[model samples]
Target: MGNHVETLRWNGSAIEMIDQRILPHRIEYIACDSAQSVAKAIRDMVVRGAPAIGVAAAYGVALEAILRKNEASNVFSTSLEEGFKALAASRPTAVNLFWALDRMRKLWETHQAKNQPELADIFLGTAHEILEEDIRINRAMGEYGASLLPDGSRVLTHCNAGALATAGHGTALGVFRSAVEAGKRISVFADETRPFLQGARLTAWEMVQENIPVTLITDNMSGHLMSRGEIDAVVVGTDRVAANGDVANKIGTYMVAVLAKRHNIPFYVACPLSTIDLSLATGEEIPIEERPVDEIKGFRDCHWAPEGVSIRNPAFDVTPAELVTALITEKGIVDNTTLTAGELADFVKKNQ
Candidate 1:
């Protein structure tokens, strides 16, 4: 079941990505044969989620290498550099994008003396490695996080962090999947992540496909439900996590975290260490990507807002570490609730 949704895959000559923008309605794969095309897809959100973006960027570099495999060494190097910059520019908030590109760049630097074809093979192999590693890491995170939820747990999730969001499996939804696999009876409350409606479309669709009980509610309904004790825990996926444990995720994540704190409910961010930006001391240092105004106006081809109305469509928001109960990673869960100020930095230092 976890393998059913292939977010993106290399099909020998090109990168085939599931067109997430039309997901849960029509399953389509868009082939990207060049780094520029992959960058466009990432920027346009044809393939999203931090881990998935990272994997896509890695493949983007590989695609560039493949495209330039027959060129002169200097031309190949220049082209690869352009590819790196393009993928890096695709998204600002997801640290994993840069991480994956950096990993590929480092590998290229070490083996750059080789011919272009050999370098292309090395880059492609490394891209495949990153993809496989992401799946393994997500499964490990699922196992570690599944233990946190008791049987009959009612979990609240935002955005779409299921198999559709990653190479396979998921982060937040992976924990729910793991819990169900362990025979725990759990239900999910999916927030209809506004504008994009990832929750209402992707999350709900994934849950329903897996036969998991999922209830959909408007983005504004979380606080009310929490006040009524309908929510047991909140789990969401992050685009980036700071060294101090602050999180940058979907725009509504900050609100959900605040409400979870008010209800004394655990707010867990399921992410891989790749999403952690050690250079960023706090969430303030993380760059927020403001999406196009059309996203705020309405869904595709649907408009309700008045003409020339103002809009602030920041794709992400920061949640201070103080409000985060714990961070679920492949290594283990970091319990932020018990830590004093600045201790998350210590953890990052030790782990990093």
Candidate 2:
């Protein structure tokens, strides 16, 4: 396995997250002392990925509890509700964020009769559990996903789904790490995810750090490589998966899935159970977050596009379930190509 990277941690007083916005160049941590600060960090992308956001939001709820431990019951309850709403509004596409918040909220409601200090301790403990559980879940998903690739497989991935994206081991990248650990030779082709450039910066950096063979390609280069039979399989991490197994991932994921279908290459989505939202009937109902037009202009401060040109920047796109060969989950591998909404929902319920 690759070197374990701690994406975020609770230091007893504050939740500290690695600033993903300036990664691979400047290594910095943003200390969130309140739920508002944690929400801001999520909005600004100081910490990202579905699992990482969920864990961070868990800590955000705990931080709010700690911050309001000495306040009156009425004030404490009102302030905590405000914190929940702020975090819930930070990101719309990732179901894990709302999942974690709902879990914490339910726990708080169930134990609200306790004193404030005790309640704060319970929240902190639960947050710690969520963080640790995420790491375990990712490793399990890695094992299940790694089994899908044979020896000497060339895996193509989009964006950064490595350890930087999650709590410890990643989702999609975790499969590569796991396969390599099991004595399977796996090389990687990372897409230079545009605007943010997470793959060019974060994914390449992670693979290089762990001595895994990696090739960087522009976003448009995947189809060309696949046409040449250079790509073995496509593995990606999802922000959310609908009841019918429709996947919502990075903005370019749908194009990649369609290309994989044309090439007859297996396309896999490494998804955790928390990312699955059974309430959504289909991908058409998934809310796509439109980022600021400034992101389309250029990376950071380097602007290349001419000013005043309108840019539509949807942060993510949905891939139909039929395009997905399978979904590698912590419980097991889900055959998604022929999965029905009812079957998928039943699987989720059985697992839960």
Candidate 3:
């Protein structure tokens, strides 16, 4: 079998990101040469998924450094700050985006004494490191999460949290990959996340590429499947995990979690430490990104909704800590009891 797909790569001169907007049918890469272009790509969903977006944002800073390699010290510093802000603003729900940009910002602040050329090299190196570390961290998460599954486990996943959603192996899907690698038989049920269809277009497509068994279901079909005892577990990736372990994932994730609980099936959230936001005390505090009305009206230029209907398209919804079975992280797993008391911060502190 071939190696896992790379979601994005720093190609010496630019960040080459797989165009997520038109996948399965067409495989193309977007070459981002400037921080502005990278920001646009993130906002436009050319490259998405919390971890992937974070990695792309780090590369955005590197692109800024490369562009300002010949500028004066003050000019370079000012432009760098602007680049960081732009990348941070590209998406608000994912803490990883802010976390990655802040890391780059701190690196620049610490190395202000270096010349533009040196700074450019340092920024590029750091971006590459971030990208590589994401894959490593995801695999570590995969190992821990995979251990939670039994033989012949059937997992229900939301959105496109496969290789397309991360730097390499995915968060939720990574767990499935690890279990399969460990010689456990496993399959997946992917929800066709509406208004985006990331699950249908990306997740299912990715599973086929990896030779993982997958079943496609509409967003509303989850509870029905669970009611019939078809789903053994529900595992999904989050854009942000609140201090209390309340998960903010794709819009339908809360429903899936609720159904999983009703069916007495384990609902797990696979995430990295970077995706956890200690600043947010609860999921209620996590910002929900609302998309343009066009997305709700149609997909990729196909209009189906009535021309005058209203739409509320919140990109994500928060699943309270009470609904979570466990929080799977690169550090370790935190049970729902620990998560509910809002003690995840304490767990992270001790582990960090």
Estimate the overall C-alpha local distance difference test score of candidate 2.
0.92
Give the Cα-based TM-score of candidate 2 against the true structure.
Answer: 0.98
Q: What is the C-alpha lDDT of each candidate?
A: 0.91, 0.92, 0.89
Candidate 3 lDDT, 1-352, residue by residue in tens:
1185568977779999989898879888989987889999999999999999999999999999999899987898788888888888899998999998888888988998888999899989999999889989989899999999999998999998878889988899989988999999999999999989999999999888878899999999989988888899999999998887889999999989888888899999998999989998889999999998898998877899998899899999999988999988888888975544547878888876
Error of 1 at 226 (Å): 0.7
The best candidate by lDDT is: 2
Q: For every candidate structure, what is the RMSD over all alpha carbons to the true structure, in angstroms?
A: 1.3, 1.0, 1.3
Structure candidate 1, residue pairs in collision? none
Please list all clashing residue pairs in model 3, or write none if there are none: none
Error of 3 at 224 (Å): 0.9
How displaced is residue 35 in candidate 1, in Å? 0.9
Estimate, for each residue in 131-181, the C-alpha lDDT of model 1 and write its tens digit. 999999999999999999999999999998888889988999999999999
Count of clashing residue pairs in every prediction: 0, 0, 0
Native-to-model Cα distance after best TM-score fit, residue 160 in candidate 3, in Å:
1.2
Model 2, C-alpha of 113: deviation from truth (Å): 0.8
Candidate 1 displacement at residue 11 in angstroms: 1.4
